[model samples]
Target: MENKEVIEPEILKQVAKILKVPVQAIKNFSEEAAVNIISNTFSDESVAYTEYYKYTINPFEKWVDAMDKNEQLFKELLKSEREKIELPEKLLNEKKGNK
Candidate 1:
């Protein structure tokens, strides 16, 4: 029987789910080499991209860092929106009277 091959994105997503790590952490070596590279990276965590002569990055770390930076921006946006909402005193009184 011929052996079946696993593809890159599928292996990456599955490993991320199983390891609770992140899809970005896994790099696809190639369409055909995906399974082998995944097994090596998971076991050693030191697999290098020979073409680049450096270790590949897990993308999730960069994503997390970016989100962290955006937190302050989001907080400022929410605060600005809240400050811009001006409730007239008459409207406030009317709402209280209705209640």
Candidate 2:
């Protein structure tokens, strides 16, 4: 893509805060990677919780930590997935696109 659509900086920073991870971890990722992480995350709101068990160490606080983590993870997962999918050349070549 001429331009890759990445997550907003402000939103990514907010997510980083909840995950206790550095903003650069997510911010520095390529747009395609970012898209995958977020898409994979929110693909199924209900299933999102199940995925967390695989990522973290202790029980997350309900409504607060858990929710925040899920949201942040969703964004990251979408980005990761996007990176895997690889934007098609046609889309990437769009005159207005940026990648």
Candidate 3:
């Protein structure tokens, strides 16, 4: 609703849902309470650690494979650049020899 009266309660309820707390607890969010909630949530080792990360296959191996591909691509690019530079150099040398 456009009115603060209607929107404030809804906002508080939504915030409570996100925080996993009751609306009553968030109606008056003090600094100390906020700090305590944050500290408690973060003290746990798995605040946002999902199951996907836990069950993933060899991550380092995948990273190494990607790096190998990147290295190969870079080597190809380097060779192409060297050919471009050498082409100009060879053309200049041929012109000098002709003159």
Candidate 4:
């Protein structure tokens, strides 16, 4: 595979944004180090672009998928916790009402 000689400024900015790090971090990276950083950062488009030095698939897809999974897991956990706390209160309230 062909390696990129230098990463574009715009791409570096995007990577920094995704990683929540300063653009200087990316700029200061050696080419190989930058490539490794992009790959591990999991910014799909950035990773793919760094790999092939071109756009491939939709980069946002991976981010969206990860966010969706997290949201679903959070909802499930909230529901479980709510049930644990509510069940006892529900029983107590019902018993009081019936007495």
Candidate 5:
């Protein structure tokens, strides 16, 4: 796989503003630390909501349990429906000699 540049300093500065942290902190973060910081910062509300649902409403667990009950049916459907999906002509013809 090719390693492409994904982040720019300006983008990091903007993210720092959203996260309410110093841009230098983001700039100094290692890749893994930066990913964790961004995820935790942005997903605080989502984490709280998930916790609330898990404890108070608990719908997600019920949904997962229901899905687990029908897992075999889902697997069988997936197996029986296996077929090669077609790619667009342009993609298929990207390399010469392709039919």
Candidate 6:
């Protein structure tokens, strides 16, 4: 018997499902065709061209911008809290003055 690379049937089925082809097609592929599939799947330019990578290239940028906006909002909230604390203190001081 000739030596052949033995891929799991389940793995071939998943690959076929992903490729939208039948498992038998994968099983029947020639070595060159198999190489072509692998090259097409992960070519050097694939990362730059894949739709998912387009959004992920700078994933942290959105997070950092959101964090900055939150920081600004937190500063405003802190200022409002300081104002609220001062309001009661001012009212108490005025009551003392009236005594």
Which candidate should be chosen as best, given TM-score against the real structure?
Answer: 3
User: Which pairs of residues collide in candidate 3?
Assistant: none
Q: Model 4: per-residue lDDT, tens digit, 1-99?
A: 028878788987888999999998866758887678867777654333455576577869988999999999999999999999999999999999999
- TM-score order of candidates, top first: 3, 6, 4, 1, 2, 5
lDDT of each: 0.72, 0.74, 0.83, 0.83, 0.71, 0.82
Candidate 6 residues 1-99, lDDT tens each? Answer: 135478777877888999999998877769998788778877565534555654545668888999999999999999999999999999999999999
Per-prediction RMSD in angstroms? 14.8, 29.3, 8.2, 15.8, 18.8, 6.7
Lowest summed-lDDT stretch of 10 residues in model 1? 23-32
Quote the lDDT for 90 in model 3.
100
Residue-level lDDT of model 2, residues 1-99, one tens digit each, is 226577777877898999898998865758888778788876565344554555755554555887898999999999988876676645667745663
Error of 4 at 31 (Å): 40
Task: State the displacement of the C-alpha of residue 79, model 6, in Å, after optimal TM-score superposition.
Answer: 1.0
After superposing candidate 1 on the true structure, give the runs of residues whose Cα lies further than 4 Å from its correct spot: 1-56, 86-99
TM-score of 1: 0.30
Residue range 4-99, candidate 1, lDDT tens digits: 465477866887799887676544335558777777787674765467665578799989988988998899998987766655656788899999
Error of 1 at 93 (Å): 8.2
TM-score of each: 0.30, 0.26, 0.44, 0.38, 0.25, 0.42
Show where candidate 4 strays beyond 4 Å. 1-59
Stretches of candidate 6 above 4 Å error? 1-57
Off by over 4 Å in 3: 1-56
Candidate 5's residue-wise lDDT over 1-99, tens digit each?
Answer: 025356777877788999999998866769888688779877565444554465665799989988997997888777766633334544566755554
Q: What is the lDDT of residue 62 in candidate 4?
A: 84
